[model samples]
Target: MTTFDGLPPLRDVIQTHGLVAKKSLGQNFLLDLNLTSKIARLAGDLTKCDVLEVGPGPGGLTRGLLAEGARKVLAVEKDSRAMGPLSEISDVYPGRLEVINADALDINPLEQLTAPVRIVSNLPYNVGTELLIRWLTPPTWPPYWASLTLMFQREVANRIVAKPGNKTYGRLAILSQWRTTPRLVLELPPEAFSPPPKVHSAVVHFEALEKPRFEADAKVLERIVAAGFNQRRKMLRASLKGVKPEIEDDLRAAGIKPTDRAEQVSLEGWCALAREIAKT
Candidate 1:
């Protein structure tokens, strides 16, 4: 009845706790220990790092993180039903796992986790992108976590690592690549989850850079990127005309063609444009 980690198999835990995946909260539990453990391993050398796990339904990935030697795990679960099962995990791990029965979106996990942290989660689909943006654009540079190993829908994963000229490229791509090295590490079929989601999912690993890849004002860069992609089909000169009094001039000054569309511009090009626009 027990798995290699000495914890009961996730199904047994779910059954014992009467856990049911709630679609409204974006819960889709990964029942396979080996798969979850593999995901934990992808985070790399967790022995010294405190890990943050969101929505630890039935503690599948939670157990993975502990078994793989994470120094400690702060698991934030929104569903009250999960607290009981997760507490059981906390009992087994003995001070290694801390479960917070609150929405991951509301609280600052850094308050509970220690230094040299890494965030590893099979993020609930609903708030995954929003949480990623919050992490990507924290108030200061070199935010708490040194790395992020997260799971998202395949479409989103592609967008995170998408390159200029790819249809998937947009604000998300710019933000992800601007200050971090993001790569698609693994892919999963829908059947992997307890109540399979409608789409395939993938894991992405992001290592934070000491500084942004290029020098540009963060606020200005975000404004430019958002405006540029808001009307991605229009030429930069037209799409960004409202951004400033003379955006075409700024675009040319940045070495960007006035006729180029948003998807045609690289991250460096966007930085250049942001820098140029900031001058006016």
Candidate 2:
């Protein structure tokens, strides 16, 4: 049977291209076009925006994004096996799809796409968090993408949107919330993929903020957060030893109690401390 877009089923696409899930590449092909389209829709109206996709194995999510009215799609695939299938998608969509045969980690996708882009993908598990951090901390304000709709392991998704005092909250939570408003949009059981992963997956939507939620030097903020969470069990005075000898006074000036532990402090509190440190 044909899919909604009249293309052959994804399993056929995978088999035709000899695309097997490569554990080394962190591949788990999603055969369900319906689920892929749902992920596409979560990116909202794609009629006017370019979509950036990472790890489009057998072009499952690529097909969905094109069919759902993406003005253009720039799909980066590392595994050469999936290129044949993605090439087929490029033909189906004509000028609307551009397949880049390169590692997602090696390429700067923002440099290739037009402005007002939205990244939508089922990211490769091994590098998903690293990619998210790159996007969240691009060197300049008003980042290349307008929003991000990406899938990750359930645990990673929780960390991205976690709030203060939540067990999942940590470096990811601080980095994500500092620059964007992230939401948990969809949850999929392990069975959603061809070879079911041991952990469930989730899709997250992150809309970039026009202005950062707080003001601090990005480098300083990272340093402060890393110090605080690296030794989360310790008091600020002890945990921030790497920061400066006067770090305790700095924390106090930021209105964060010196006695508070890392997890107990809010994102704003971290930013406040970062701002103080930057002044030193």
Best by lDDT: 1
Model 1's TM-score against the true structure: 0.98
- What is the TM-score (0 to 1) of candidate 2? 0.98
lDDT of 1 by residue, 171-244 (tens): 99999999999999999999999899999999999999999999999999999999999999999898898898
How far is 162's C-alpha from truth in model 1 (Å)?
0.7
Clashing pairs in 1: none
lDDT of 1 at 242: 84
Task: Mark the regions of model 1 whose C-alpha exceeds 4 Å error after superposition.
Answer: none
Regions of candidate 2 where Cα sits further than 4 Å from its true position: none
Question: How much does each candidate deviate from the true structure in C-alpha RMSD?
Answer: 0.8, 0.9
